[model samples]
Each structure stands twice: as structure tokens, then as C-alpha cells.
Target chain A: MLRVLIFSIFASSAAFAAESGGMPQLDPNSWVPQIFWLIITFGGLYIVISKIVFPRLSESIEQRNDYVSDLVDEAKTLAEQTEKLNNEYKELISNSKKEAQEIITNGRKKLNAEFDKKKNELDKNISELTEKAEKEIQSFKSNSIKDVQTIASQVSGELLKELSLNDEIDQNIIIKKIEDISKKKMGELN
Target chain B: MANPMNQFEVKTIGPKIEIGNFDISFSNASLFMVITVATISLLFIFATKKKSLVPSRLQLLAEMAYEFVAKMISETAGSKARPYFPFILTLFLFVLFCNMIGMIPYSFTVTSHIIVTFALAIFIFIGVTIIGFVKHGFGYLKLFVPSGVPVVLLPIIVVIEVISYLSRPVSLSVRLFANMMAGHTMMKVFGGFVISLGLVGGWLPLGFSVALTGLEILVAFLQAYVFAILTCIYLNDALNLHH
Candidate 1:
């Protein structure tokens, strides 16, 4: 029933359109409605779109732009932080290497100083021992010379007593001469 | 055979009301225009309702359309034309929908009417002229007077420029009204042939009708785009007054 009613309306209007001449759009009778509706529709749309629709759409676009910019800013900050951390890590490694190098050099210097001190002490001790042995030899040589001279004097006196008179003068002289010769020999040996 | 011109006729559709002598009555043109408005409103409302950073397909399409008009106006008229962005968009969509709707079987195209298109054109003409006058005062008359012209040719050139300027609305309105009316009439004529020829003979006319319909749809979009762009150009002249 609805379809029939709709078709009938379409048919009747279609007939009217067919009967019109030249151009039906020019008919003075229709101008009023066209103008009327155009104003209503155009005016309404202009207001709604300008005031409501356009603003909202532009706002959404603006929001998207802001979101993108924010993301870019965050990425840039992250990159900068990464670069800083990388530099810091490198710095730390270099600093530790410098410290280790300093420690090794310092230990070497201390060991060299201790070794030099011990070597110097050993050299001083060796020199002192040699001096003491030389001094002892000098004293022993003097004492042996004295004993030899006394032995020579006693032997000469005993020989003279067994032989004849006048032995004192000759024995004394011989003992003196032997003492001089012993002294000369001891000096040559020293 | 049925008259091809018959499709352009306007008939009252609802209860008719009067204001004194003026006939302000509801008609099919009004009906379709109302539908266009509702469709535009709803489409925009839904398109913006989400307002997601990542737009949906619907939102993207809607944004493209909105930006198309916005960009056209900005490029043509510069920032001075910002005020008329909504008006220009409304005009474009209204003509576009009317043309598309007219393509529907058993539907009326509101833009097919001369008074309708003429009224729109004339309104634009007057508004642009007023803006030109208001912005530049009497200086706008300089638009017709080309610089560095020989004194002998100045008067003649001015007259031609004035005539062309006066003809803007006529040319603008006629371009749209004539295109729609002619295409529809041709389609109707072919459609009549299809019926009269019957079966085997009708096949040829039916094919022509199909081709014509496709052509008409293209013409519809082009005409609307042309109308809106021209309007932006005119607005540019008024706001900027390059000459």
C-alpha cells in the first residue's frame, strides 16, 4: 500500500514535469520556494559548520599535531640522554685506566728506592770488613817482629858462652843487626 | 514522447502556507534541501565525534572535504577570505548534493533551477562588491582601469571591463543551470526513446542513457567544484583587489 501511494505521487509529479515547456526551473511560480528553502538551508548550514563542526574538526587536527610534536620531543630527549650516558661511561673507563697506570708507576718507583737502599748498605758493610782485616794484619806483623828479635839475641848469647870470653859485646851487636834486617823485611812484605 | 524539460518543474509537496501575498510553501526542492542540510550536519557530527588522534576512514573523508574547501579558499582569497569559508563550503556542498540527488531515479535537483543558481550567484556578486567597496572604498573602481594604458584606449577598456564585471553573476548562474538542465533533458529524451523503441531497439538508447548518466555525474561534480572555485576567485578579487 505504501509503495503504491509513493509510486502514484511520483507518477503524478512526473506527468506534470513532462508537460512543462522550455525549462521548468525558470517558472516564476517556483522561485519563492527555491529562494525560501535555499536561505533556510544555506543559512543553517553556514552557522552550524562555522560555529560547531569546523571548530571541532580543526581542534582534533590540532590535537594530533600536538601529540606528534610531543613524541618527537621525547625521542630527542631520550637520544640526548643516551649520548650523555655513553660519554660518561667512556669517561669512567678512562679515569680507571689512568688510576691503574698511576698505581703501577708509583709501585715501581718505591721498589727501586728500597732496592737502592739495601744495595748501598751491603756495599758499606763489605768495605768495613776489609778495613778491619787490614788493621789486624798490621798489629800482628809488629808483634811477630818483636818476638823474632828476642829469639835471635838469646841464641847469639848462648853460642858466645859456650865458645869463649867477651860474648856480651858481640851478642848485643848481632841481636841489633838481626832486628834491623827483620824490620826491613817486614816493611817490604807490607 | 514525454518532454525532456518536464523534469525541471517544481511542484508543491506539503501543506502550503502564505504570508500576505508571498507564496512561501513547502515543496520538493525544500524537502531535498532540508535533507542535504541534515546529511551534512550528521556527517560532520559523526566525523568529529571521535576526534581521535588517529582518524577513522569516515573522519578522514570528512576532513578531506572540509580541508579541500578550506584550502581552496585560502589559496584563492588568502587569509582575508577566512570569514567566508563556511559560506563557500555550504554553497559547494549544497550544489554538489543537489546535483548528485538529481541523478537518483525519481528525484528532483534543486540546483537545476535558474532562480536558485542565479540567486546564489547574485548574492555572491553583491556580497563581494560590498566587501570590495567597504575594504577599498572608491578605490575598487580602479579594478576596471588598467594601468599604463594609452589614453585613447582607456575609456574603451574601462567600458569592456565594466560590462564583464556586470556579467559575472549571469555567467556564473547560467553555467550551472544550463549544464544540469541540458544533461537531464538529454537523458530524458534518450529514456523516452528506450520506451518507444521497445526490447531490441531499446537496447541502444538504454546504452546511451547509461553513458549520459555517467557523464552527467562527472559534470555534476565538476560544475559544483567550478562554481565554488569561481566564488573563491571572486572573493579573492574583492578582499585583496590585486588589480
Candidate 2:
């Protein structure tokens, strides 16, 4: 390969530098060239690495870290949002249940109040009618009793007139006797 | 037969250039260093061209190098070394390539030279000391004073600390230079033995050479890692003044 040939050319030329006085590394003469090349090569490498290579590598790493952190932040925000929505839904369900219980209780109370009011009104009317019926019955019984007493007295007097022995009887006594007879007949009929 | 040690000898690759009496001619070490830099540059350029998040093979390698250096810096120096990441990463890659390329048969190890290693270590030392002074002003001198040392031992401890601090460049450069040079020398010695032993007995020393090569490869990587990590630690000490 062309690359290998070029390498060999440089290699052969450099190897030829090994044939002089002592260990070339320790020789005073060789230090100059080594130092010269060192300055050029090392200095150039330093400039290149510091100015260009390192920064790019560091930037790439930073960019990757930033991308990962951004994803984490987004995921955390979405999780928080979901939690908020879930809490709201829970509150809604609980509120609806509370409202339903209140409605049932109100309906039951209203229905019971209406039923009690109608029953009380019917009770008052029934009591009044019963009292009136009792009073009317009492008045009718008193009138009938008085009339029976009077009629009994009159019949008794006519019978006594027809009979000669009744002339000796007192008026008061006759009335009392008629009343007693009517009382006896009332007791037997009751 | 050519002496095995002759491989370590220095020679000029081309026409000599002179600058004010300085003999800075083109040489093997320079060539290898140039090769290392070029390869490193091409690798990064190719690896990063696509910029794909899902990495290709080269991209993965590039990314690994980036992360490896970054992690090492953060671990040893903390995040304050963020700005110095490129410098440290460059040093690691360069030294790593230098060590690895030297493992090739008949190739020069640029890092094997004492002068080169010392130059790098001295650069690191001077830079770190400057940073320490800039950050802490005169307070940087307090690095030698241990916080909890008994008063009796304070003088001795401070002396020790100061010596160690001053010896940073020497220790750093010598450690890397010695490791690489010793490994390569040992391999060469065993290679010589294999040749001298001929086919019948070469197998035993050859096996040793193989094992030593593998070990040397591992050492090459480790030494570079250690070198960079120590640099980071020194940088940390300066940046934070955590002596």
C-alpha cells in the first residue's frame, strides 16, 4: 500500500540515525532535534486538542444530559396533571352522592308532613260530628219523656172520673203516680 | 555481528542543519516523534469527522481516550483541572504513542531519552509552580509545613517536604526514562542471547523475550499513565493547594 511505503521511507531514514556514537537517546547531539520536534508536535497537539477536540466532546455529553433531564421534567409534569384530574374526579363523585342523599331526605320529610296534615283535619271533623249527634239524641229523649208523663196523667184522670172511687184522689198524688208508671214503662222498654 | 548496544546509538538521518553553533540536525528521535504526532492527529480527525452519537470503531477509540483522560484528571486533580484537560490529555496520548511505537522491532522510543523526559517533567514542574504561586501567592510556601506535625519534627519534616517538592522533575523524568530504557535493554540482551544460542537453545531465551516483551508493553502503558496521573496530582496540589 502507498501508506505502508511512505511509512517505510520514514522508518528507514530514522533507523539510519541509530548508527552514531553512543545511545542516540543519551547523546548530546540528538537532544536538539528531539527537543525541536517535541516542541512542534506537542505544541501543535496542545493547541489542537485544547482549542477544538475537547470542547466538542464535552458539548456533546452536555447536550445528551440536557436531553435526558428535559424528558424527566416533562414526564413529571404529566404525572402531576394526571394526579390533579384524578383528584377532581374523586371530588365530583363524592359531591354527587352527598346531593342525592339530601334530596331523598327532603322528599321523605315533605311527603310525611302532607299526610299528617290531611289526617289531622279529618279527625277534627269526625270529633265535631260525633258530639253533635250525642247532643241531638239527648234533647229528643228528654222531650219524649215529658210528653209521655203528661199523657199518662191525663189518661189516668179520665179513668178515675169514669170510676166514682177516683173523686177522692189528690191531683198531686195522681201526677206522681202517672210519672212513676211512665218511669216503670221506660225502664222495661230500655 | 554488530553489538546489540549499537541500536541505541545516535546518528543523523539527513543533511545537518546548523543554527548559531547548535547541531539540531534531523534524527531518529525527531522522526518518531513527528510520526507519533501525525498519527495522533489523523486518528482524531478521522474518528471525529462523522460525529455520530452511536460510535463507529474509531469514534469509540477517540471517545475512550477522551473519557480516560477526563476521568483520570477528575480523579487525581478534581474538577478544577477542567481547563487543563486538553494539555494533560495531549501529554498522555503523545507519551502513550511514543512508548507503544518504540515496541515495534527496529523502532526508536522517543520517551527512552533522559533529555526528552526531563524536558517534559521540567515543563510540568515550572508550569505547576507558576500556577501555585498565582493561585495562592506567598501562601504556596506553606506546602512544606505539615498541619499536624509535632514542633520537634517540624523542621525535619519541612526539609523533607521541600526536598521532595524540588525533586519532582528529577523523579518524574528519571522514573519514566529508567523504566523504558531498562525494558528495552533487557529485551535487546535476551535477543542477543537467542541469536548466540542458535536454533537448539534459542527457544528458552526466546520465550523469555516474548514474556518480557509483553511485560514491557504493559509497562509502557502504565508508565505513561503514571506520568500523566502524577502530572495531574501535581496540578491538583497547585490548583487547590491541598498539601
Best by lDDT: 1
- State the lDDT of candidate 2 residue by residue for B96-193, as single tens digits: 99999999999988898888999999999999999999999999999999798899999999999999999999999998887787677767767988
**RMSD for each model, in Å, please?**
9.6, 10.3
- For model 2, the DockQ equals 0.20
Query: lDDT by residue for model 2 over A45-125, one digit each (tens)?
Result: 887777767776666666667878999999999999999999999999999999999999999999999989988989988
lDDT of 2 at B139: 97
Q: Candidate 2: deviation at residue B150, Å?
A: 2.2
Which 10 successive residues of model 2 chain B have the least lDDT summed?
A: B1-10
Best by TM-score: 1
Model 1 C-alpha lDDT per residue in residues B1-243, reported as the tens digit of each score? 876666676789878877887788988888888888888888888888899888999899878888899899988889988878778888888788889988998788878888989999999999999999999999999999988889999999999999999999999999998778767766877798899999979999999889889989999999999999999999988888876
Question: Which residues of candidate 2, in runs, are more than 4 Å off?
Answer: A1-23, A81-190
Q: How good is the docking of model 1, by CAPRI class?
A: acceptable
lDDT of 1 by residue, A1-190 (tens): 6346334534544465656554576578888878988898889988888888888878888898899999999999999999999999999999999999999999999999999999999999988998888888887778777766665565556545644654456667666755765566556545
**Model 1 TM-score (2 dp):** 0.73
